[model samples]
Target: MKILDKYLLKTFLITFTTVFVILFFIFILQTVWLFISELAGKDLDLILVIKFLLFSMPRIIPLVLPLSVLLASIMTFGNLAENYEFAAMKSSGISLQRAMRILIIFICVLSLVAFWFANSVIPYAEYKFINFRKNIAQAKPAMAIAEGQFSDVGFYNIKVNKKSGENGNILTGVTIHEKPNNYGENKTVIKAKDGKLISSEKSSILKLELNNGYYYQDVTPKKYEDRSKLPFVKSAFKKHVINIDLSELNKVDTDQESVASTNGMLNVSELRYTLDSLNKNIDNEILSFSENINQRVGITRTMRAVKPEQKKKPLPNNLLSLFKKNKEKLELIKTASSNITSTIYSIDTTQKDLKEKQRDINKHYLALYEKFVIAFACFLMFFIGAPLGAIIRKGGLGLPIVFAVLIFITFHFINTFGKRLSQEGGMTPFMGAWMSSFILSPLAILLTYRATNDNGLINFDAITTPIYNLFQKISKRFLPSQNPQ
Candidate 1:
């Protein structure tokens, strides 16, 4: 290895390490702030907290590492250019491309490492993080309930106006909505003036003792017309005690859902497998629906034993004439109308459901492609930053940081927008995943070519001189700058 390569690599690595650590810490703080509701007042031990942070840290690498590389590359190269080292190298017959050769090799290796990390480590961390979240409330049964907002613990949605006592066991004006199913329909509500929570870690039950409360259970009639009555069974109690199973709380589902969705929790291989099943599920559902619709319409059964082609003349405009009786004709019309309404409803419902399933398919494809996106992003950022630094010729934390931040923000915004659009079926998953890279890649190439040939970001003389001459001629033609000069 040449001395120049060694020095450049060392300088760049040092900057990269510093930037990575700082940015990672900043992002970690943001993570902690985001989940503060879960952590604060939970009486969680340090070890659990550390585990939570550790599990969350890996997921931030994709965001942090790219920004780190961009900033570090800019800073290192900018400093060298500012110090005239790059100029000296250029004078010594070392082109910008030659100077970047060692770093290019390093970036290639980093990109591969990034791909491996995204496929293996990030997915593992995501899986573990989801599990940790599911189990977090179990650490403290009381922790499951927040003071102001409704908290889902077990089958009940619990809210407390205020909680007092050392362990926040004493609740004032508590309201509980008990959901009998996972889809969040609540048939039972209990309100208490005061309550106390009693729990034991070893036991899977949390006991709630309430005072001066009312229990209201809504009842629905089987007849649709009677539904508006909204009959509910209500009872007042001087004191009541409810036992909630902690094990059931562990079964609680979130948007990511029981860790079952695994949208971001699967490696590329597993994603492909899951995606295949999802596609098959959608196809089978459509097929089954079609068969059901055909049967409902009675198309599969011949309406008449004789074929319609046997008719010598056209049927009467009054098709009901064949029925012979007005009552029979009216009944047939009513039945047909009802069937049409029902079929329309079925088609609309199925159409909406199919759209959601298609979105799910898009999400899986996005997840699969994201692993590769992270890898490519490393190369993208490096090419952009290295050449940009050479062009700007500014060093330290000032201009380089500004340039890196603006570029990274643009990349991040486009990436987020593309993913959202893709999820909504606005674009293909492949396009959404690579959109930011595609937009910025040409800039990378342009900057590299310019820097290699000792060209500035723009040929100001070529542009300004033409504009200046045009303005001078315009002035000479319109209003001569006079004899004042």
Candidate 2:
């Protein structure tokens, strides 16, 4: 029994890891290809690009690892079923639940690792990646160009034919090929007679000045004779400054109101702050609305009672009439004053509302923190995989791969949809992210039971047949009444 268990576990681990690597590479390559064109003229070093991609890996791994586990498990189990290994195990008195007990333990450990990766490692990697890019953007001007190299300046590809040191900066004969504009196929090439590079550490600006340069405008010629000569462009001094905002380039903010490191990752403190601010704002708006309503009512009453003629009357006479006729107005003024006091009270209540909201948000964060159980999904894959193997009774890649893909697709879709909704404040982040796996736990158990008992996969055909028939009947009933023939 021990030998058999070791063999199955080994096979599962090998296949799972191989497939996961393949999928990871494919995703990484796709991302790199999509962004390569944008980096064409930019002085992005190969080493830096590689480092950036490496740093980004931690962020994506947490997302992909679970699916990889699902796929690997399904395939592994499907293979076991095909080979009758599960049947043999059953014959030897090893229950499906007993076999899966080991996997459950494994899952628990993996879950903890995933939790740490998401809440700590990934966020730190993201922070460093952003800062590195910002530093690259603000690096020295001379470092921007390499001799006999084609470098990108924003959207333009520039090459320098010759270089010499002049006035604390590099001087060169420059060739710039600007990328296509909205109106043209491609930009005209510019050959500068001479150019100078300037850099300042205090300001994130690289200055390039060119002298005695002629330009050719690339546009569709309207007349036949107009195409006779290229547009004569002469410039005495052409200076360009590439302004880079180092601060905006990086997403992390290090300031008084900036999120602290303890609250930096998907942690409780930041969420609490956001929730508290929103609740306070809502309370303030509610109070302001009440104040506005009272003010409006008071002004309306005052307007109705007071007249132009009354205002022009003798002061005593006006005062007497005001007393007689404007008693309602006076009462409204008093009521409004009371409402204003209530508004003040509401302002005081805002702190309490904020605290309550902070507490609620912290509850969610704490819930996620405590229930780090979801991290074990990697190991849970084995339970789903091993039993699925016995049930399918298929071995090689074909059937296992298909089953794995179907299960993974479903899981991925659920997880992603939930994450997006949660991030947009529609759902609790912890619940949204883990809901799919939580729901699937029962299904895995059921599948394992059926497989262990030698019962076949559920008869979906019979279940669907009735539903399809009902749908057909409903459609027929709803159809527009045909002419009685």
Candidate 3:
């Protein structure tokens, strides 16, 4: 490599690394804050928390890497332009395009690396992260119960007005409603002033100790003779103990392969296969429904036993005979009307289902295209940031950071809006996925062109010059006496 290429690459790499680390940590902290309530007061081990954060890194890296590239490119090129290194290079016969050659190649390679991570590492991490969260949720059954909300715990639904104590196990003003079993016809209700949950790691039972409670049992009569009177039982107790089975809650699936399929957890090949299968199913359903509707309407079946040409001669010549004939046909018309209504309703329902399935297919397609689109965005962002830095001729965290954030926000907003539109069938999946790229790529090219020619970041004079001259002319005509001096 030439000395200039080496120097540019070195500076760009240093900035990229620093920016990547800072953005990654920022995103991770944001993720932690989002899940703080679920993680806190769960008596979870520190190692488990660390593992959760580690599993989350793969998902966060994809979002961070592009922004890092943008900021680093802007800051690196900005510094070069600010310090006159770019001018020196230009004077030495190295054009802006020539200077960017090595870095562009580097960014292309980085884009491929980003794609590899999205295609491989991200899917695995997404699957593991989802299952790990489920495991954590199952491990802390008591934590799932929040204050002032009813939560199902085994056969009972329990609600608490207040939860205060270590590990949030102590409950106040508890209300428990026991669901009826197969043989029972009535529900049992229990209200307690306070309660405490006690469980051990190795035990399969969670025991609830209640104080100052009343239990009410409803008894319904079995025989008709006793139906006139309703019976119930009420009992008051200072303390009550309820044991809940925790065997199911403690069971975590060890096989990661058994995790349910999600769009975010599938690679391109899997998504394609799913999309194809869904489309085939939808087509077959539509065909079958059409045939069913045809048969229901008797379009393909003969309603009369005799052939149309072999039927007897018509006999409805008088009013009485015509009335009798019409009466017999009325039943047939009613049956046909009912069948048509039902068929229309069935077709409407099936069409709705087909639409939902199509939306799911669109989601899969969007996800597949998103991986490649975001990878390409890294390259696009560099083109934008590098030239923008040269044009602005400023360096450091202040201006560059602000510009990068604004550009990225616009890109992200367009991408999100397009995805929503595609998911709702308002736009094609490919177009929706590539909308941001299409919008930004031209801006990048324009900035690169302007920067290469030594033009200002924006040509404000071209627009403002005409307006200012027009204002001066209007002022002179309106105030001629004052302008004479």
TM-score of each: 0.83, 0.55, 0.76
Candidate number achieving the greatest lDDT relative to the actual structure: 1
Put down candidate 1 lDDT per residue, 1-485, tens digits, no spaces.
99999999999999999999999999999999988767877777898889889999999999998999999989999998999999899889998889989999999999999999999999888988977876776556777787788987777899999988877799999999988876745899999999999987677889999999999999977544355578999999989998987775644433233566677989999999999999999999998999889889976645445578876688689778789888999989888877786787678879999999999999999999999999999999999999989999998999999999999999999999999999999999889989999999999999989988878889899989999999999988999555763
Q: Can you write out model 2's per-residue Cα lDDT over 303-388, one digit (the tens) per residue?
A: 66798787764556443455555777787666656666555654566656555555455444533442353465665555676677
Instruction: Write down the lDDT that model 1 would get.
Output: 0.88
Give the per-residue Cα lDDT of candidate 3 at 402: 96
The models' CA-based lDDT, in order, is 0.88, 0.62, 0.86
Model 3: how far residue 40 lies from native, Å: 1.7
RMSD of each candidate relative to the true structure: 4.8, 15.3, 7.6
> The CA-based lDDT of model 2 is what?
0.62
Off by over 4 Å in 1: 145-152, 157-178, 181-243, 247-261, 301-317, 323-329, 480-485
What are the per-residue Cα lDDT tens digits for candidate 3 across 428-476? Answer: 9999999999999999999999999999887999999999999999998
Model 1's number of clashes is 0
